[model samples]
Target chain A: MSKPVIAIDMGGTKIKIGIVQGNTVLSSDSIDADSGSGLRKRLPFIQKAVEDLLDREGISLAEITGLGMASPGIIDSIQKKILSIDKKFGDAPGIHLEEWCLQTFNLPFSIENDARSALWGEWKYGKAKNFDSAVIMTLGTGIGSAAIMDRQLLRGKHFTAGILGGHSVINYKGIHCNCGNKGCVETEASTWNLTSIARSDKNFAESPLAHAPAIDYELIFNLAQEGDAAALHIREQSVQVWSACAINLIHAYDPEILVLTGGIMASSSQIVPYIRKHIETHAWTPWGKISIEEGEFPDTAALLGIAHLVGN
Target chain B: MSKPVIAIDMGGTKIKIGIVQGNTVLSSDSIDADSGSGLRKRLPFIQKAVEDLLDREGISLAEITGLGMASPGIIDSIQKKILSIDKKFGDAPGIHLEEWCLQTFNLPFSIENDARSALWGEWKYGKAKNFDSAVIMTLGTGIGSAAIMDRQLLRGKHFTAGILGGHSVINYKGIHCNCGNKGCVETEASTWNLTSIARSDKNFAESPLAHAPAIDYELIFNLAQEGDAAALHIREQSVQVWSACAINLIHAYDPEILVLTGGIMASSSQIVPYIRKHIETHAWTPWGKISIEEGEFPDTAALLGIAHLVGN
Candidate 1:
């Protein structure tokens, strides 16, 4: 059997740590992040969670091949370090993650951006296996994307190439993005901006969405199904924004297949067909049509991707 | 001295054939293209033009290392054939260009999309020579773009990856493009659509632009310089479209430098500063700022690029 590897996925609100063997998670644990204090303050808790997982699984540190970490922001995978943390973990770039791994477990370590890690996971062990070129767009709080071309991950000059699809301007003059760009796809149709977009509709007050306790895609989609006019408008607009984003990504990275993942994929039945039909009708792919599909692993994808990266 | 290579650049209105040594054009000839006749029908004329150039320069076919051709379409460089021709030379894909080279000149041949060829030329010999990662945006009748990542031309699953930056949707709800996508940067701000965009302005009827001999950037820029209200509005809108396109390209392909080419760079004095300011303020490049510059070669870029490809 292949040796087990320690995998960590650092997300905005939670951190998941696990002992992974091939595609199986032998043991795992999750902890809420200290959002106020940032990633640096939460390091000890993460380490303890990993230790507890191993102890519960009766696994020795010596049995682990290596440690793999997936984090939000730009990651210099070649150097095994986080290059930037954006706003999620402000102190992450200052942390010597590889050195910490060497000191703690005496194991080799690898790190990558969470989005790219998910892509690697999908490409190596999930829906995108056997495809030489593929792109994965995670439509959640923001649209996170990653691309693999010619069987190699596209890490651009600054390690920001495939991860910025959300920030790609879909409506160039429409709205302002927190990233400082105007009309980014994220600004137009992400969970972070969904409420504002819903509220902006003049008919929002007349729809069931305005009466909902909390506004989200689930509520909007539910209301739209119930024949709410404003809900339907917002749903259609969101689909168009997402479809435009899909087509933009298709044009940007000429991939053979596009895997749609993220919190929003719970409605993949509606989202997948919309984007597929848009690409089929609009994309100028003379070679052939691109395959659009749902992602295989959702919650554990980055963890699995970390396992693949470390194993490789 | 190295043996010369024959380079051919097939444009919409003209065909240029040249014998090249390194960065220098040893000898060259240009002939007007019969736009009504397809590329297959014009094969004899192209061959005769090449033969005339070789004879006039007193060079034998045996002295040439190989033949390299650049055409305005989706070129399958590996197979040395055009994949799609858009409207120009609509029957180009039916021609077996490599077979024709073998039958006529008995030489190895390679073909590339004109945009990619220009990028290679710039990367190998022009402003982007030392940069392993760069993007070139050609702003002409339409916005054409190509990218070089890690020193390799980024040809995606299909041969369309780095060459479709122009078609990337910038305004998801704005206008329908001929390519079938809505609100592409090309549709928003290219020469082909400039008149319609200008006419859509309410003040256009009262502006000096309403009486121009032809509606092109040259006329609009001139009027904008003279403080024409409608011309100035169009100029600002075009710049925004172009700047948005620049940001989208930067986000899509993380390059160290962006080289702006094509006919519109004639107004680089204004275009360069606007895009530079936009990128400096908006692009999330943690490594550093990306340098924006005008293309070194305008008219002869693809010809020079073909020379580099065949020589290498």
Candidate 2:
């Protein structure tokens, strides 16, 4: 029998570590991610997190066959290196993660983009199974997306293919995105931009949401349920943005299944249906309907995916 | 040496027929495509057009290996059938082009979406020859697009995959498209919508363009050259829309080569540079720059592409 694997999902807010067995995470843990000082500063903390998780699971480094790490930004999986990161893990390109893994665990190592890793998990073991083509759309702080088109992950010549889902323009004349484009779905709607979107509404000053410490989808959804005009307006607008994005993605990649992930899925029951209605009304799918699924393990998809990444 | 191929590019306004040898169309001719009735009514004319082209080239039916048709609709290239078409050929789904070919010329037949056919030509014999991934953007009456990713054409499960490039939303709140979506790049900038875009400009009534019989990109570009206010306003706005679309597509398909085609390329020398500048400034390609090339055989790319499609 194959030994267990160690998986790491490196994100902007958290570094999640897991011991994955088959398709399941046997044990998992996470640590606060602080990139203000760069990735090098967090190495010791990451090492401790993994060790503690292994200890709690009663597993040892010698029993692990390989380690997989999912990191943010552009990744050259074939070269086993991080290419570039705009905001998080500024030191990623300089850090030799594969070498670090070899020394730390003395095991084979592989690294992938966090979203792509999550897609790998879904495609291989979760919702995307049996489907030849699938797309993973992760909605949270910013939109994270990856596609498996024609039964292959869309890795373009630059290795940035299928990872720029958040940056695709959906409203060309709208707000300029941090990535340099304008009217991107991420700019129009997303947790990080939700506050900005809320503040931009004409009713913000007169609405109760203005008194809140910070704005997020949860608060907006909660307030909208109580018939807050500002909240309702923002919620419906975000849903349209997301639906437009979904249709745009459908036209771009033509996936059989679109797996929704990230923090926004917490209110999947309330919001997913609106997205579905919009897609049904506007998406030009002549052949049949696409299956939209919520990710089975939103928080740990990248971890479980990294296991497949290293294992395969 | 392989036998020559008969190529047909089925457009809304014209049915272009060609006798193609290698990558070149040795002889070509076109007939009016009157779809006011149905595709069945045009079959005999299509037959005559092919025969006339073969006669002009002094080629016999036995000298041709097969017939390839590039139709404007959803195509099942694998099954050699048209799946659906909203406009040009309403009876495409019921017609048997393969049977027609076998009966008329005893030749094998294959069909593909016109955009995909053009992409096949570019990828196989023109600008995209050396690239593993490529995308074609044909900006004319409508925005026609197709993609080749990971060394294969993106023919998704239903075969409407990469051909819907123009329909990808670039502005969520912009013009609604005839195909049921809003803010599509096609709706914002293609020739079919140029009139609406021009008329919406406040200066349209004062500008000389109001006296013109038709409002098209040619008129707009020509008027802009002469410093017409409405023309200039619409021209700049269209340019921005196209630029946004370029960046959006760059993110969507991640192609190494983006081959521009269709009627808009008539002003390629004047307009392509502006698009290049926008992509350079806004496209989030961290790996490297994408090569934007005008299609080498814009008028006959689909013809040559059909040759490759049928031959292969």
Candidate 3:
């Protein structure tokens, strides 16, 4: 048996830490982050959270093999450093995370972008297992994506290759993205921009969707189910954008299977089939059809992936 | 000294064959291909052409290392066979190219998609020679692309990953592509579809562009320079489409340099600057800016690339 591993998923609003061995989580904890102050101010809090979890589990640092971190930004895995954070944790790139780990735990550490880590986790232990090539799209506040090709995670020259699938332009003349690109899939359909996209529709003021307490995919889906015309139109438009994104990813990565995850997949029953139909109709795959499926292990995927990274 | 290699670039309208020694072409020949008759019908003609070229160069079968072929469409390089041809040569994929080469000359052979082969040629001997990681976009009748990452050509699981950059959707609601995808950069901006795109412009009928004898980028560019309003609008739209394609490639491959080539680049003075400016503004390269430049050796890139492939 190998020593247990410590895994950290540093998300935008919350930090999830786990003490894991193989597929089992021995102890886990979560804490809300001060998103306004950024990661530098929250590092000590994260350290305390990890230490507390280890103590509660009756485990010591000596028994821990290493730590694995999954962060939401460009990560240089080889350097165990965050290369850049996209507006979320502004100060993260300035901190030497590897040095912090070395001085605190006296153990080796590995880190990867959260989405890529989730892909690794899924490929190693969940839905993507047994597949040599696959792509995963996490549909949430913004779309996040990662691709695995021929069993190798495609970290390009600048560590920006596979992680930017969400930024691919689906509508050249559409709105601008914070990432500097225009008409990105995220700008068209992601949760962060959903309200703007919905309100921009000419029928919003006259539709039932305007009266909803909060605008979200869940509400839109329910409204669409109830036969709200504007809701149906918005749902169809969002689905088309998502489907276009799926086909773009299919063309770009040439994956055998595409795994869809994240918050919006609460409507996967509808989104999955819709994307599958679009890919079937639009994508030019000569070998055979690419399989589209919902991802398993959404919350724990990055944790599991980090554990694998540290353990290996 | 290495033995000279026979390189063949099987293009849509013409076949270019060459006797190459390293970076230098000792002798070369060209013949118009009967594109209507298909590749299988022209195999004998191609073989005879190669034989005649070798004879003219006073080279025997034993003196030549091997034959390297650069063909359009999906190619199984390991098998040395064309996997699928889009429309140019319908019967190409059915022929056993390697077996034919072996039977004819008893020599080892290698083949690659023309775009990929051209990329290899550029990386090995042309404008992209200095860059370890780069992408090449050949913009002509249609857009074609290939990428090299971390010094290795990116041939994905299905052999379609990096080569489908042109087919990426730029306008989801735009026109349909023959490849089944809608709003592809190729469909929106390529020469094969340019006339249709121009014809669809709202002001095309009112502008001088409608009276032009032929509809092509060259004519449109000349008209735009001469202050034709519709031509200028179309030119701007095409530039934006091409620029969007550039950003998409940069996001997909994460290369240090992007080489632009093909007949369309005859207007490199305008196209190059437009794409460069767009990438500089739109692409998110945290490490550094990606360099965009024109490709060298437009006509003989694949020949040199194939020579390098077979010689090695």
Candidate 4:
């Protein structure tokens, strides 16, 4: 049998590291992250985390195939390098993860954007497995997406293809996104912009949500369920933004299926069906209707994907 | 390379027929079109056009490699079938162009979306020849686009992949489009919607443009050059829409070069520089800048592209 692999899914707030074989994550560990600091400073911490996880799992470095990383940046997997990052991982573009792995673990390495990695995870073992072409949307603090066209992950020149749905402008006259574009899907509806969108609403001053300890989709969904007017408005508006995003992705990728995942989907019970109806009504797919489904694996998907990447 | 090829570029208003070898069009002809009437009625006319062209060029049927068509619809080129179309070409989906060619001229044939065919034409023989990856935008009565990612044409599962840019919603809350979307790039700024967009402007009733014979980009560009406020406003808005569209295409396809074409680019002197400036200021591309160039051929690109398709 082939050896197990080490997978690292690095997000803005947390870094999830795990040992994975086949489709299952054997054991995992997490580290709170602060990307504002350059990536070089965190190398030793990551090394220790991996070492400790292996020790706790009673596995050795020699017993694993390699290490793979799912990071928040543009990546060139073949060259095993991070191409760029957004105000984070300051030293990443200049650092070669493969060289780091060779020097430290003396093993092979691979890396991809976290969303694209999760797409592989979904396609090989979850909601996207049955569809030959699929679009994966991860609604979280930010909107992250990846697309599979004809069963092949689209890694365009510069490796930005099929991964920039969140950054696509769904509203030309709406708001300015930090990415320099106006009214990107993420700018209009993602969790990172949720509070601003709520505050800018005319109903905000009278809404109960204005005084909440912390604002998030879970709280928003709960308040909206209780018939809070501001919460309801926010929910309605957010879903529309996401639905519009769905239509945009459908037009751009022409996928057979769209897989929805990420933390914001905790409200999937409210979000999924609404998006389904919206697409049926508003999208221009004359060939046929596309199916929308919620994803099964949330926490472990990128890790599983990384394991698969290392195997290849 | 071995022999010449027959090419047909069928547009909403014109059908251009030509004989091409390598990078040059040996001879060409055109016929006015009214696509509101179905495509089947014009088959004989097209057949005669090809026959007369070949006769005048002193070329026999056996002198060409094959025949290819650039049509305005979704197509399965390998299957040599038109899969779907707009309101026009009601009978296209039911007919096989390859079979028609075989029966009429004993030749093999292939068909592709006109925008996609033009992209191939540009890639092989025109503006996009220098880049391995590119996005071609035809700005005219509509905003049609096709992307080449990593030197391969991206024909998605339904063959709708990069061809639906005109339908992508750039403004979810703007006006409703005929394709069942809201504020599509075409709805916001294409030639078909130009009059309506102008008619809705607050300046319409008082402006001299209110008395124009018919409203179009050429008049708008000319008036704007003469400092007509409404025309200046329309020109600015149209260019911005096209620029946002360029960003959307860039984010969607991740191409290194973007080639602009079509009749609307008659105002390229005004549109190209504005879009180029907008992208530099607002696009999120961090690796490097994308080059934008005007296409070399206006009337012959899709035909050239079809020629290359049949040659292959």
Of models 1 and 2, which has the larger TM-score?
2
Question: Could you give the CAPRI-style class of model 3?
Answer: high
Residue pairs in clash, model 4: none
lDDT of 4 by residue, B66-87 (tens): 9999988688877878887766
lDDT of 1 by residue, B1-312 (tens): 668999998876678888988887888888876756788888888899999989999999999999999887677888778997667788888888889999999999989988888888888789899998999998887788899998899888779988888899888888988777778998999887888998998889998778877799988888899998998988898999899899988999999999999888898887899999999998878899898988888877888898888877
- Report how far residue B254 has shifted in candidate 1, in Å: 1.4
For model 4, what is the alpha-carbon lDDT of residue B298? 74
The global C-alpha lDDT for each of the candidates, from Candidate 1 onward, is 0.87, 0.85, 0.86, 0.87
Which window of ten consecutive residues has the lowest lDDT sum in model 4 chain B? B81-90
TM-score of chain A of 4: 0.95
lDDT tens string, model 3, B1-312? 678998999876688989888888888888886776888778788788889988998999889899999887878788777876767778888888898889987888999878888898899988898787999998887788899988888878878878888899999998999788899999999887888888898989997767877688898888888888888898899999989888888988899999998778888887888889989999989999888888888888889888888887
Window of ten residues with lowest summed lDDT in model 2 chain A: A149-158
Which one is best on DockQ? 1
Clashing pairs in 1: none
Point out where model 2 deviates above 4 Å: none
Looking at candidate 4 chain A, the ten consecutive residues that score lowest on lDDT are A81-90
Residue range B1-312, candidate 2, lDDT tens digits: 457999999887788989888888888888988876889999999899888888887888978899999988789887888887866678878988789889988999989999999988988788889898888888888888888887888787788778887888887877788888888888888887778888889998999888889888888898899998888888888888878777877888778888889987898876799888888888988778889889988899899888988888
Ranking by DockQ: 1, 3, 4, 2
DockQ-better candidate, 1 vs 3 = 1
Q: For candidate 1, lDDT tens digit of each residue in A65-140?
A: 9999998788999988888765667888898989888888899999998889899888888889999899999888
